[model samples]
Target: MHRILVVDDEEAIRKNIERLLSLEGYEVATAPNGQHGLVIARSMLPDIIITDINMPGMDGFAMLDAIRHHPELDRAIVIMLTAADERDSMRRGMRLGADDYLTKPFRREELLDAINSQLKKLARFNREKDNAVAKATALTEEKTREHFREQFAGSSFPASQFSGYTPDGSSGFGVSLPPESSSTQTLQATVMFADIRNFTTMAERLSAAELAALLGRYFELACRPVVAFGGTHLKMLGDGLLALFEEDAQPQEDALSHAQRALAASVGIQDAVGSFKQWVQEQYGQRGLPSFSVGIGLHSGEVTLSRLGGMDSPEVTALGDSVNIASRLQAAGKELGWLVVASIDTAQLAGECLRHGRQELVSLRGREKPVAACEVLGISAVPSLQQTHPPFKYDPASLQAAAVQNSEMTARAAKEALKESLWSLQSGSFQSMQQSFRGYQIIRKLGEGGMSDVYLAFSAAQKSEVVLKVLRTSLSNDAEMLRRFIQEYAVLANLTHHHVSRIYDQGFTDDYAYIAMEYLSGGTLKEEIRGRGTPGNSFTGSPAQVHGRVIDLLRQITSALNAIHKLGLVYRDLKPDNLMFRSEGGELVLVDFGIVKNVGEHTVGLMPERLVSTEHGQVIGTPYYVSPEQATGQEVTHRSDFYSLGVMLYEMLTGSRPYKGDSLNELLARHLHAEIPRLPPEHAIFQMLLDSLMAKQAIDRPADAMGIWRGLDILANKTGSLPKARID
Candidate 1:
């Protein structure tokens, strides 16, 4: 057996890899970090070394560099395991003598294939290896491939499926005829076109060997679903798959129609992406590469299957508008952010399974009009073959819960079934409600809060993206809160400052109170900060740039506060989440006007509505960032927002909030009494800003938004070329 060494900072990932490799009959040894990994690599001289880049001590790169310097470990086939998005780390690893790269979330087959491919290279080039051992490796590799084919395809993947592709880049969409068969025929079929998004760009960056390995893995995963559903996978289209589920595609014993089978196959491919995403997250967590997703377009119509060339250089292909349209739909999916974009006909023709997504009129480039299609969310039904190819998608929590009630499958099957049953329960009511709620057509829910669920909706009259903030029906009985919501909207309706969120409309449905607002793509400052690091502070850039950037943001927040403060009302809940970015340009806007929301005066919660008031009716804001005045239930002013902004600034400059407490009362006490913390040495220039803004007595803070803005202006002028930042 070939020996392998697995190194990673994460215990779970290291053990998972060790288990996978051991089951493959490899002698696998594991290490928790780079220091241990290097020690083991020298002692054991493993045949293959698999190391992750990020670790607590040393790190994979340093360990690999050390191995290169040592003559004994130089011969080891080094496979660097990296987060999918860590291209720079991969390049560095390769320079340090890495033999191969395996992205996180890789399938067991992909891992085995990487090792086998490397072994095959050694067998061919290394003269000392015995011929018998070389032959054994090759044979074993072939057998492994065959087993994989059986595992995913549920049968053999015919070697001659797409012997040659035609020149037009269109074969009319079919499983081509035999090499000697020249007859052309037309028939009705359901066609599924799936292409990897951004594959061309990926191909450009990768070497021939890397590209070949990635494409092989993707095709294997992609083709399995088609072959499993009895659809003929047409592999002529590069980086894309074309499958046909025709009259004779399904087995006679199986009662599924071609459209249903095609739908099932599309769902399977989509599920593979979902599984791959989980794997990537498991391996790399938040530091992973961009998750790969396929845009699959399904349509059922008449297509022509054609054959080209003589028996010597024969090619089986398809030709028809149906094929062209199907391909177009697949490409359109990328722009629409839909995984499966299928025609209405395919959705209607599909059997009893719930069509669990919204309807859309998809526009195509060459066509004069739009094609009606459905955005596939997920299918409630499993494939007719009984289970998906990647049966690892079981929800373990749900399975354990079900296991308490009794059931066991092929060591894993029963758990997957239980998870599927749970999904089936939720998906029963998954279709669009199609209720005539004014002119807003609800696409899908964007988020849910304690009192409301927000949906991405479209206004037919406005012809733009809109968000429907639908409050729960229970809120209707709270007439005082409802009256406040309408009253707040009426006042906010006139505040047309660019930084204030535009409220398009407001109304009440039989089920909820709703407000329509413009959809901002840049998300919120909280997401922007959190994506970079913990709690918000972890920005990376130069010292001046970071300081200047913070100053610029403070200026913008003060500018928005200036607008709201003009109305003589304090923004009780001023924090990172309430500050929204209009776009990538990063202009900030204030959102979720806290005045509109009124949860019970006593309830302390995270929601914007939870602007709390003690039993004595002294009002307060959210904890952590709550101003001293708000925490103590004293009178709040524009200066109160200045205090909150100070907390926000402190959280940004440092990696933590300044105050901490075990409970709400404790937390409030800290906010009221805690001394303002000093900025890091490099950022000490801003200590003056924090000192005054976070004064225990509200009287010591800046008198108005203008006062805060002027302070920021002085800082900006002090630092030339302001508004640029990051930590190095």
Candidate 2:
């Protein structure tokens, strides 16, 4: 319902106007004068304001001006009321931002018509506004997808390549690519390459943890500005970053060209690094660390965009002489003592004269000709731009000494690893019955499912151990299962997290569809629980030790689920058997997306689809661990997975499932109506989390996966089990 406020010195006039508008079903408020009216307007945020031109304490003109100044109230319609002969007063009110005017002794129809006309105008404006927002969003997404298609062309279903769509290309780069993904396209674009000026010396002096933290913080600071100015943060090359600004970028300021946007981003990066230098000095100044600074090089030219690497783990990066030129310029900046260097092509196309500290035709390696360039101090015309920092999904101080001993030069490695995997494969024909599932040698059958068999296989193509799942020969003709099997691969492709299983390749041969994924040999959480012998007090340790272990595992599990939930996808099946530890690292990884579903608005190429039919009381998950909502064949969501997490916690603390029965029907009924299982009296500190997670209603559960992760973090910190988390 729309609200209207009437202000006048005359009590009778105000009361009459209120009564009349109230009768029309409007929420009406009356004020004796402009001062009271302004108070009411701020409080109620009325849709329309009607005020007398003349008032004792603050006049209508003053009130209207005040309303216009309040961002929250400025959108409201204001109407002026004046005596019939006071034409000048009405004109003055109108000039002061009044929407309409009604003279005293006016007919009821005239007053109503004026209010209705203003409302119609406001409604029209809103419609146009909504349409414009949606159109702009659509255009931006299409532009990103167009670039993605250009980079990853020749795929049969090119649209499916990016279901994890982030306009800044965060997900599109350094994540999984489709099999047979060797495609490229050339386009005119502006590239900015940035690297630390004295990174090698810093690495030598600072401890490994110190260096990683510096790079992590620096990467966050630098990449944010590039994304802010409508540029693609394509890659974090060892101690350096490569970003692109295409001609098609939607300028935040319409007057700025793409080149100007790139230049502005370069300035923004330099400014950010300036601040970071101060932080480094404060952190390691006593150690006599070298001065901190960044050299940013900008160039504009034709560059090829492509997905480079193996089938399992592919990264999107720009390749061409232009990209190389930018890299060279960044290096050249070190010798010239320049902060930002721009090639003549970029400076000229930036749509404004750059503040050049020096200019020269410098000889560049690998090129016979010396290119004209300038040492850019700044761009006076470049306005203050809005920058954004990506989510802190990692703990920066968690960096260990191993990071320094054998880590990549781009030492944001931990945080970068948190932001998103490594997987490869070459194609080969099957030569023997035992060597089926092309390019992979099936080591042995690990387990059997109703529709498929899991095998520990070695991929000649990837040259790594992978878990190969091949559809059963009988179900080879089952189109639905085959589709779902492929769907599972599609779901895993977009999810690149350490706690989430990595997918390498997928193909159909020998009348069967198979997926090659990372091998987790540490076994399932179920096996760990079962190995503890009898049910009573399964975990054998001091209370603190047990609690510490439990918190550690839950934190890892929640982190995995957090990654899944953020993608707008749900891992519906969350049984203990489905969670396994990576062989290389002891970190738990969420596996088995056989029943995963895309259920949120931020969906990518994978639209909302019921992978399996849910008709006639069909339940999709294991009844023992399923949430009450899932047991009833109702809509499942990310929160539903939390319910399963609750069950897992109960079993880990105790030695048995939360709810048990002799038959399926009895078990499901218990899951629907059973009370939430409680932790033992000794472990009661964790009851709050368990109760909320196992609440019968999904709404009563923790709001999101990260909330639970943080809750566990708090528990760990309170008990002095784990260090306080670094991420905010």
Candidate 3:
């Protein structure tokens, strides 16, 4: 009988599930909550575990994490029980490795179906495992040894090419021969080099024990692809590894086939590493864990395999130009900001399987002539293992024409455009059309803020249009300004949210430091509001429609803020101007993280002290949307963001802001001392929400973004404006 464990905080629910499972002829164990379930699970080693999501001590997600980490309990089928409205909790449970989930109040049939499904899956997995073992057992000892020899030999040189060679008896791949004998063989093979990007920085940040554990996990994951694709795992070089694939006559695999396999293996390794990185993010969150990425390079050529080293330590290793070229290609990948790079030979041999970017000439250390290479975008049908900027396709002829036209058009067009909109002008000398910034061709100026100028530019490396934000050259020499500018890039680089703008690259030149990011052309939420006007005023939509739109925007805003706060950063500035809409997806992206504050760090204000009165003596935020705590210079938290968002929501619902002030000082005073204006009784629910969000005390407000989101969702549903589909 399949043993099942049922864990829930409610005794009635646990007993019901246990009784139901027992009736189905299964041995059922019960635990009051996740903490108790973990103990029962370890001792019983049940075949399946069904647990509730929210518990007093250890939650279902934590229990699932523990089970997955356990040696023997990891294979148990796990299912979660969550309320229908607890979407975030369910998602967290899934990421923590729960096999499936049943909503609270689920039907008996639904519960049984989920359990039966998991059992079916478990049976299939066991059958496959047994079949694999049986097949392996079918091979004779000598044949198994030959099989191993073929696998390793195919990854280096063909067996026929190594005729008359004998093992050196040192175990594994050691070289041994008669006292005076030394021999070498030459064969065509594909050599691949892969290393974790930014490993040195990661090592510096992590403890020795943590780093070793991380590397152990990384190597275990990184070698799977090589073995799966019939390549030999040669050796590990600290954070990097080398693998080889050689032509095989018996298998009828040629040099081209080996190259393709090597490329596939490289892609697989990238995929494996990516999965590991994601697992880390899920387990430990993003901030504490250092981010990880891998770079890979492949080259196919003839290399001499020989026995080398002293008499006592003779080892068999590849030595030739091909190995050097492969190593250089890996370095080139890192230099070009690419996950994978390949020589022209490898790309050509791999044919359709390789989708590559622009072909470039790379200067290798000892090579006199530059070698032609391509940035490997991905395999044709294989999805990228890493999440990063899309590969740029280089079109030399189009780029040349665009560059020439852009040079002639940008300066004149930008000046004319800025003259019509004062917001596009900053307090610095504008860049000329002829000037190039970080290999990007400035098409036109987009907009300008107090500290930086935004421009629409074409990135030659990415082969796409991007938004480039460059710090004012006049402020480049200012240390604090530079730190603030770099902080935005640093924070943005680590965030991966659909509603958060993606940053492609960041660098500094002689004149300015710039960040290249995703270009969203749909304008800002401020513009959207201006175009639509306030609800029941200039708006043309029906009451339900207008309310629905507000709900949608609120859902997105709160969701983005939730993700941002989870990263341990508070977005102090939450105005419509910083909320952007993407043209392609129509998703509102959070931008301009310039004033973002770490959760617990206390820092004095860089702005003028006269801005407002605060206990911390540092007031920094927009006047109209500033929270009371911000105005008083008190410590800010995630709740401060809700207050600002509340101000925007009020403006969206009505024709004007709740409070009015003639000057900055007056606005600060009103935010600190004035009473919130009452809304029309027709929208009482929304008014209550607004009042709660804009509460004077942070503790009086909704606890966090998630709480605000849930509140909005509840209100929207009651008001008949609940969206049919979730915004995220």
Candidate 4:
């Protein structure tokens, strides 16, 4: 019988493999980890061994080395179980004579096929061994050595002796000697450090092999832009990487050139990371794996480059204040919630090519005084190389041509066109106010925010007016902002409701990013409320007409909230400004979804409080309409929407919010401690319904939107205030 040994620190994985192999008629044995697997292998002399790369004691790499050197088990067929990102471990295993490997979460067919393939190779090797030995005896020692080298030349393992030190930090072999340095040189360079944010906390939820896979993929994606923008990748420092862009010595490239390349590389790296995260969500998001962010820092100065350590373990690295400053900048990025940050020197040297945010004075370690720094947005214009395929040779002539094409009007254009182009090119903002996004033409500016701007636009395809939400110029390259802006489309696209504003189209252009949505010309509820002056004094209609109109509006609002709740979404920022009336239909629609949250998703970074409060003392949502739980930094649910709705209803009827205070703190305190405002005795039923909706405790409120709507309908009927025409 063929005996196979399965080893993994995870009991479920070990047992699962053992069961699978047993079902295939092989005698299977299981071990908790690599160390235990070695003991079993020595006794059982298993025909095959399948081991995990990451274990508690001896990792798969260390154990494979041991097995290859052992007298009895040296010929055993070994298969490594690794995660997709653990390419380094897989390569090392190949060098140590492992026959095959399977990525984690493998299918039964894949696992079985890998095993059978290795078994077939073993059978072929056994048959050829005697003939190979006979032929070896006829050759010289040098010839035999050369033959062996040629046989395994395709293997990716480094040409170093295999060390048996356990990767899991267990007591095994002593430390190995460091690799020797071969050469060193001094040069001017811009250094950058990109570190994964909150990696330590995120690591707690992932398996070792899983984490290895994630990090490996992240490094691969992060390193591409570095090389693409002419930066040399130095080394990976655990959850981060070190890269340098050196000034060309022959042409005597200036400091500005190095800084520009480094900054551009940083932008590319940030974009690539964002794309990777989105790809992961599209591919493996259903598996409940967490997503993360990266922080990058850039600095330019003189640095020493050297080949460090022994010949067997050589590492090319940079050493100087530039490297130190770069690393500190990465840390500052994390602290300040910025994706990319750079020293003032780097920013100044980058010049017009890069856009930057407000400058700040930051204290760096090992420096006597605080240094000036700024947040880097990205390259101001489309790169010339972007239009070509790689071996992206930098051609100055091509860049000049492209620059002229971008900065000057077309040859067929009039003199006015040339003048307009000059004005736009000279202005700090890359695009004019009447810029076009995709097929939508900007008509006028509606409003602006810290991160983005809203514009009134006309969509030729839709043949209707649409709202274009464009990201601000300074934040165009921000990964987090771009992500949130994209997420708004994703959220709205999935939701098909009459009362929810629809997204017609969304995309990014060379100059800006934007989302086109259905336009509402009837103005916001805030404007309507303001137009009415004081609530009770503004209406001159009969009491029944006023009450019936109020009921109709409440029904529409509640029905919209119900539709949102059914999809497990909460409009955290529900307020008058977000409610708008359609021009053609006059139906109220939930307009802004900037802070919408998916129930149970624990996203990180700014605006995370929109979803649910993961930590104390962090609050989100508008103060006047915020729920009690939300004000206290507690988990919010659909009930929170009800509280906001109740506050809105109170304002609609009374012309003011139920709770009032001189400061935001006092307002929040009122929500938590203030008594419920009493209504007029004549309108007792409506007052009772309002009191129920505004209950302090979530448990005391109506169960859902449907329940509240039904309750309000019944109240309207009882009071003979039901409208002749229902909005729904």
lDDT of 4 by residue, 86-187 (tens): 888888889999889999789877887887767645433332332232222222222322332343233322221111111111111111122343455687
Instruction: Please give the lDDT score at residue 723 for candidate 4.
Output: 46
Which 10-residue window of candidate 1 scores lowest in summed lDDT? 402-411
Q: What is the C-alpha RMSD of each candidate to the true structure, in Å?
A: 20.4, 26.9, 24.6, 26.1
The lDDT for every candidate, in the order shown, is: 0.63, 0.67, 0.66, 0.64
- How well does each candidate superpose onto the true structure, as a TM-score? 0.38, 0.40, 0.40, 0.43
Model 4 lDDT-worst window of ten: 166-175
Best by TM-score: 4
Better model by lDDT: candidate 2 vs candidate 4: 2
Q: Cα lDDT for residue 601, model 2?
A: 67
Report clashes for each candidate as comma-separated counts.
12, 6, 3, 6
Which portions of model 3 show Cα errors greater than 4 Å?
1-435, 473-475, 533-539, 600-615, 722-728
lDDT of 2: 0.67
Give lDDT tens digits, candidate 1, residues 290-372. 35677888888888766545444334556677777788888666544567888887887775674746565766756767899
CA error at residue 55 for candidate 1, angstroms: 46
